[model samples]
Target chain A: MTTAIGQYQYDQVDRDFLAARIEEFSEQVARRLDGALTEDEFKPLRLMNGLYLQLHAYMLRVAVPYGTLNAAQVRAFADVARRYDRGYGHFTTRQNIQFNWIRLEDTPDILRLLADVDMHALQTSGNCIRNVTSDEFAGAAADELVDPRVHAEILRQWSTLHPEFTFLPRKFKIAISGSPNDRVAARFHDIGVIARPGDDGRVVFQIFVGGGLGRTPIVGQELYDSVPEERLLATLEAIIRVYNAHGRRDNIYKARIKILVQALGVAAYRNEVEAELAQMDIARYRLSPEMVASIEARFAAPDLQAPEGAAAVLAEQRAQNMVFDRWVRSNTHAHRSEGHIIAVVSLKPPGEIPGDVTADQLDRLAGLSERFAYGELRTTHLQNVVFGHVRQDQLYDLWRGLVDVGLGAPNVGLIGDIVACPGLDYCALANARSIPIAQKLGARFADMTLQEQIGALQINISGCINACGHHHAGHIGLLGVDKRGEEFFQMTLGGRADDQATVGKILGPALPEDDTVDAIARIVDRYLQERSGQESFLETLKRVGEAPFKEAAYDTV
Target chain B: MKRAVRVGAGEGLVITANRLLDGAIVWLSADHTWQTAIQRAEVLVSDAVSERLEGVQSRAQADGVVGIYEIAVRPEVGGPVPLTMRERIRAFGPTVHPQFAYEQQEGAGA
Candidate 1:
């Protein structure tokens, strides 16, 4: 039970799989370089391998499965950043890390390095069931019913190189949460699965289908209230099969399963899935209990037996250092194990790109994770890192170390911690630059005291309707639009991505680029002034409605 | 004199595309070659914009250069300034990473 889960150890078969693909891609790349394969011919081949020609350069998106990474894997990422890319890598909204400045020739080597580390870029992009994401704290969270990663891993294995679903209507996303609290934004994914313990103590799945955010953002409708553990695969198959058969293929905009589910009312869609399931042999997809148990056994719980008086020591440190106290308050979460906490290392330092980590910083984080976090780290959907099993006694030391490495911002869920997509600056599909706006907002909310006072606000920014930043799910969402080719921003209020996931309502007319930060400040001010007692910004918005925020936002001087 | 080479005309456009090999920001040059330095851009008048851009696109298609388009630019003291903020950033590189910002290639000129 205590075996180290140093990434799903890629056996010889996995290695061979990657090796063959790598060889094939290398040849393709060479041919393309030597004027053999045309751009049209080479594009699909490159995209299948997780390569994209972005605004400036060829970007390589790597699959960091369920956002879990060991020290060595991280170091390899750092190496890739330094060697192949522009000294940095961006941890994307999907929990995958993308190198923005990858050269086409260097991609094979990068994939080789990733393969060596039991990591590969397969299904990170293109029309496939993409890198399966789950709760960053799946195994470690106190309220977890079951580790979602166990099933996530199962799905990863089942979906990897699957022949049938490779060329779907659009790229598919699946998310699993072990806990009721949806930390991975499960409601916004194409397939959302919740693992809950049954009365008999066996794990069951509650499945949601067609949940996605893009040109058309919609919360996934629940397809199955509770699917037996054995029926999970069959159930998922039925859902995907229905989607594949009926999903719009001619129109790229209307291709997602969310649109399909919406077009056919939930009941009708469910009926289709049910019909599909009825025709299928469910037993063939059913996993034996022993198979499930073996996967579960591999996810060994970290040794959390800290030295006695660890809590006392943490309290003493908190008492001695106000800064440390602020950090613990903002950045740490309760762990299932005693004397341990899930420590979030904020990537959103003031005026920095939300998820950009320098190679040097990544190397340092890798070392720190090895030293303090059981050689394991998890990248959150919020674009931050979580040390799942950091001892309370060593919290202060870890904080100090993180601060030295420029990863400590002490504003995990606060306004300063913004979630932004790489907009026009990097993305080809963007209308405005998200990073600068995030930088401006971060700077405006640089006051730690003010950020702490504001408390637990999710601010998400997207360059376009394709809400890669999950702006539709933000407490305060900023969508960048091109108003006659000039950058303008639309603000939305009251949206959230929890169990009660709601898409934000647009507040009034879109504001000019220059007016964005000021409007945000004004909105925050309204929330602060109008809120009753300890009601959060979202709570206040829900209670008093968006009128106050709208008024404050529109009241131009 | 030589018609004063009107700098701020509506079609004072530059053919810009990402390089085929590395996806670097490149512009069509007077010599019918691609240059990484936007300073070396060959601006075309209104009549030539479409034909020149089309020709450039065709030439670059096999080279793997993508998203070729004519970007409007106004002549500044030193070089042509891209009209939109999008093109400006693309011409100069990301504002966030100043170290990796587009630098003048050794032999390129305005």
Candidate 2:
């Protein structure tokens, strides 16, 4: 192997394997294009790298877990945009980027380029393993028990082209949440891992399995109360092996782990995972302490010296700039450090499509990450960017920079803090456009005072029920449906975004386009009028039930 | 008069498919006059572009100013379709979802 950059580094064996795979695929594509290879022969090769041709031409989706990227990695994406794609990329609600147009010939080069930056399209698509996702605020969130990224990365390394598990019956998705606030939609993934402090004061994961949305949406079952940190990877391997051996391969839709879990029940599935775990050769497959240490060392945060006069600087900014202060209050979360705060950049502006960042905006965010946030950039599942370690002193400067770019809205946890997917407009799967509805809702609640009065509400919009926007997790969820070539929306209320999360209950009949925003306004207005001064939206909705909200939402002219 | 327009991102070109048709893909050129490569082409192909332009075209005729044919025009799928402001808005979906309750059910069924 080539000299290791560090322990647990990307060795020559890995690089050579990937390179050979790319060349083999390239040759396969060449043969197909030249009429030497049949579609059957080429299918497996394309499936290996997460490339797929749907009803339209080929679409290549690259998974970015919980939307975390360093400056260098962002630049690499920019390279992919400039080189392989048509100078732009579409970011999906799953924290992935889809390049809709791609020639089969150039895919190998794209893979090679991605390999250079320690990324690949491996298992991003197809009917086998998919990329693992975690909370975007994992390592940096003050409220997190531990960084879920470590576990996600570990899973990613283990699952990448594992011979035994590459050909599962259907696609599998795993999401982990480090934050107590369920930001990663853990309950909706095939496997959900939530990090928590165990009895021994060590961080362990509570594992859930089988939750998914498609033709049938079912909440996942809790498989483990707490799995020891050391045994996490082995336990995951066991789960996969069990699913691979028994999951239905006859009907493609019934092949997902969700069906397996449903068929076996949670108790049986747990028993199976345990049985498989007991049979595994732990000595051969387990991650050694040294390997774990090496990976952890690579992710160590830079030493940040506290800025002088940070509090006074923030105080002055807050006093002089109402907009900046509102942004800081709504969009910025407190950091563990005395002077640093995590500033979120909301992409959900009124009337704008969700997760639609322009190339110029991406470049600017990358530059800002380098300048004011110690070069760390994170994309939240709520469709926003987090400058993980921004100093309080730089708040005004950062706000000014964001304001110039039309991103300085302070509606983070308020009703305006909306999470939406690109609906019918861009997605072949969507029934309606979710962005415009989200935008209108955001603009309606644009007043900072009103937003603060509403307080800590999540409004999630999904074009369809695939729940890409995690509508189920929102306190107020909006789902789009198409009626006779016309768009309609359904409202669900009383959902939670925390540990005791529940899917929102649907209100009444769908409202008209012009009336929907006002309908939401009426709901919020009723909450404001009826709620006790300190009660949040979810709490108020729970106490009053759906009757009041339903009445308010539909009573509008 | 008939014209073709390159809509969305990629290689699939949309043709008027016949003379005197107006679809969202049709537009004025840089010179402030109607022009379309797809409408002007002698042949059209069944490809990604054709699939995208399927319903947005006029009926094909034996002899018309614009003709729609399906052929494999190009092998490579280009990037996102560069949409006009109007197209971008349409691409986003309806302004509200509740307005079309029946359509929502159909979408879910699909």
Candidate 3:
């Protein structure tokens, strides 16, 4: 029998908490329908429960904390999709699941369904501390320093319905990473914490603050070199309290902690946080070593001993089938345990929405996860699913299963695997469409050989300056703008999100939507020509600079 | 006409709002009910635009219809076409997901 690892099990108290919330929201919905509550008053209530009024209908976002979910939860999601949404759900960059076509009237039922499955939409939206996200490969990755989900769960429990943070100047985002690779884009969050082993073999957190990507993109500053495990919550409280006091309240644009941190400078911000920490009772929030150990115990690694001769079998299968070979090379990642692999199931296909998955697809994935992945799955920041515990011997069968389901696309980290926001088509703030652009690009680079030759590249597209698609972190970024009632795109290059993160630089004047594909083609062609042997697109651009690319893009246009 | 002039769209106004109960795109009709059909929309002419817009606003507030606004539309042979892309898409649905568009439906409504 498979043991559930790192999955948060709700106790009777937890279930009661969510059930009470559902009843409260149900009553609130009734009051709003009867005109007892105005839309102004109801908006926050709905938002706190993760409901949003989109261009077409009310959108409901469900939290999958730290990107962890089991087979049953995934099946439940499929059921919700079939019953409530229009057959599909969109996975977001923050590792949350969003349904774009939900009706406001059906949200109460949806919450109840979610509560039944030990899940809730709590803190998925609203100004309070949103869902704590981490690397999709949290416990399973070989390179992880610690299981980040333990700390993430601790933060989740402490921060839920946090009274002091409910009405912050703007929304607050926190991300954690246990690995040095920084796969979760932790540096881009408002408060990014990285766990590392201290000198005494005890886990410590390296805190980062003020990093965000919106209209104003800024790389985070290092706040503390190392904070002890017990002091994490108190340190976080100090940082947030400082932000809550000094963050701009007058203008919506200047309200985020990133802006305040930028205004105060890293040194001054630290001084304020230090001042707050000095006055506060640190013992109140300090997690005891035993408490932390108990939390960590819940996330014990699966006893998955690799099967003997599995690698040889996998190697033989790879040599026989070229498609399987390419897929294995592209989609499967190195596993923490020997004779196993972490397989990324691509949600992106040619001429389809970037992060959308149908109900049938989710159901199949759930079944597959249970069969091959120890009944668990992970949602990545790139809007893809991960079967984090797949045995090497069963990979061929898993590949066949995925291929049958039309999900065997070998495009992870390739040009075809694009990150795009719901632009003008669905979002009210968008001036231009993002999906069509991404689709066109994906189609343009459909050749697997060409994609492999080009190497790792990220093309992020945003409909507006809100930067939901994380254009700032893309190697080749496209931001859609409206110029005189016409859709135009601005290109940026050389941005990356690793241990050393950097924001992209704008290329030049915006090009018409019709000319964007051609512009991108020219930029890529320039990189292919200028690159030294085995140099990546980012490396080539960094070496030759934007002048050559700009010359090719604008001169051709 | 005065309010239309303020927003820089001079004439041919159509009252639109999201239905409070379902959040569906709806137009204020001549009968004062929020109907899903764009063809059944009450298009206010030059002089009557301001007066009719105010009436629709009050009615919209009372009826729980949200984000009520007057959009510029040009009278056509088949139906009135919204001037801006936003209003046009609102009248229809997502341009990408054409199946979800109101115009593509059998009844052809929001």
Candidate 4:
């Protein structure tokens, strides 16, 4: 028997809560359909429930909190895809699933189905605090200091229907990281929480504020060096309260906490938050050590099995099959448990839409999860699925299963593994089509050997300046713009979203869609020439200072 | 004629809106029926385009469509075509997913 840990356990109370929410939304949808409520009034209500009317049809975003999902939930998602949406669902950068072709009327039934599985789209959209994201390798990764899922769950519970701060100037995002490597882009969130070793060698939450992407992409500043465990929630509340009171309400563009923090400066912002904290009853928001321990206790331990001589057998298999060896190396992470590995199935196939999984694939992956990972899985912000507890011997079988289902592309962080938003294709707020750009690039670098040679490059593409695809965080970022009537793309270089989080700067003037892909290939060729030994693309760019790459891109174009 | 659009092309105006019940893209046809085809839209060729637009906007506010606006079209060989890329995309479909386009669909795929 396998134990389910770190995944939120929903009781009857939680089920009741979801049912009530669905009932309320169902009534509102009815009122809108019957002409009792105008579209203006119903827009916010539909948005709160994660329903959006796009260029073609309605889109529904379902929150997978901290990217956690069970086998049953995956199957349910497959059902949603087959029954409600098109044959596929798109996983977003925020670790949420977006069904692109939802009808406005079918949303009530979708919510009811989700509620049956102890899921709902509350706070997935709207001005309220959205779903809390974290490292996908939360509890299973060997390098993690603490599982950030515990804290992420806390944020999810506290922020849901938070009446006081629900209607803030703009939407709020929070991300947590317990790993030394910041995989979740925590630094780019409105509130970034890093579980760090304090002076006493105990875990203390390092608080960051004002970091965000979009029109004004700003890296957050460390608000507190070390906040004690009991004070995490209280400190966060104070910080949010400050933003709610003073954040710009007039201009939609100047409404994010980043703008307010930039305007007031970090020092002055801290003083306001500190003053607010001093006045408030800290005890009310205190997340006591005992409470945290209890919550941790609620999580069931993984009943991992040890297969005799599994590693030796796997080594034999790898020796026989070089292709499988490359896949094993690229697609798995170091696990916390002995003889166990974290197996990631790539959702990105060469020349296909990034983060899209078909209904058939979802159902099959659910079965695969049950066989290898104790029926538990994770969705990464990079748009991949993780089987958190696979034994060494089971990996080969799992790999074969994935290949059969077409989820076995071994390029997780390579150039082929791109991040792109639904730009002009489905989104109403887009200037150009992002998927075609990704498709052209992915096709160019389709060869596995070529991608491996390119070595850990992220190419993010956004349809607009909104940065939903996180163009600011890519090693090679492409922002799509509409010049006159045609599509043009702006290129950026030397950006990364790891521990050393930094934004990419524009390399050269914008190029047409036809020329942009070719220009990027030229830049990659320039990097191959500029690099010394096994230095990364970022290292090469940082050393050469965008001069060679800039020349390589624009000169040819 | 005087709205949030770039002035271009030849002929006239056509009222387009997302039908309230299902959010389907609909165009005001020659008989003032809200049909799903842009080709069937009534093209107003007269100088009283502003008055016609106002009447449509008011009627749109009170009825079956929510986001209602007029599209500037050029009378092409096939039918009246939207001037801007935005309207053209709206008229045709999303470039990436051609299957989801209104024109390409077999009765809008249920």
Tell me the tens digit of each residue's lDDT in model 4 across A196-260. Answer: 66777756888889998888888889899789878898888999999999999999999999999
**Runs with alpha carbons beyond 4 Å of true place in candidate 4:** A1-5, A197-202, B1-4, B9-11, B45-49, B61-63, B104-110
In model 1 chain A, the worst 10-residue window by lDDT is: A1-10
Q: What is the lDDT of residue A23 in candidate 1?
A: 95
**TM-score for every candidate vs. truth?**
0.96, 0.79, 0.96, 0.96
Clashing pairs in 4: none
Candidate 4 chain A weakest lDDT stretch, 10 residues: A1-10
Model 2: residues >4 Å from true position, as ranges? A1-18, A37-47, A52-58, A82-88, A100-109, A197-202, A511-515, B1-110
Residues A180-261, candidate 3, lDDT per residue (tens digit)?
9999787889999999899898889999999999988988999998999989999999999999998999998999999999
Over B1-110, each residue of candidate 1 has an lDDT whose tens digit, in order, gives: 22322335443778888777777778888887778888888877767876876676677755457667777788776678887778888888887778878886533421
| CAPRI verdict (incorrect, acceptable, medium, high) for model 3 | medium
True contacts kept of each: 0.58, 0.09, 0.55, 0.51
Of 1 and 2, the candidate ahead on TM-score is 1
Query: Second chain TM-score per prediction?
Result: 0.80, 0.24, 0.77, 0.76
Candidate 1, residue A512: the lDDT equals: 97
Candidate-wise lDDT, in order: 0.87, 0.67, 0.86, 0.85
**lDDT of model 4 at position A455:** 90
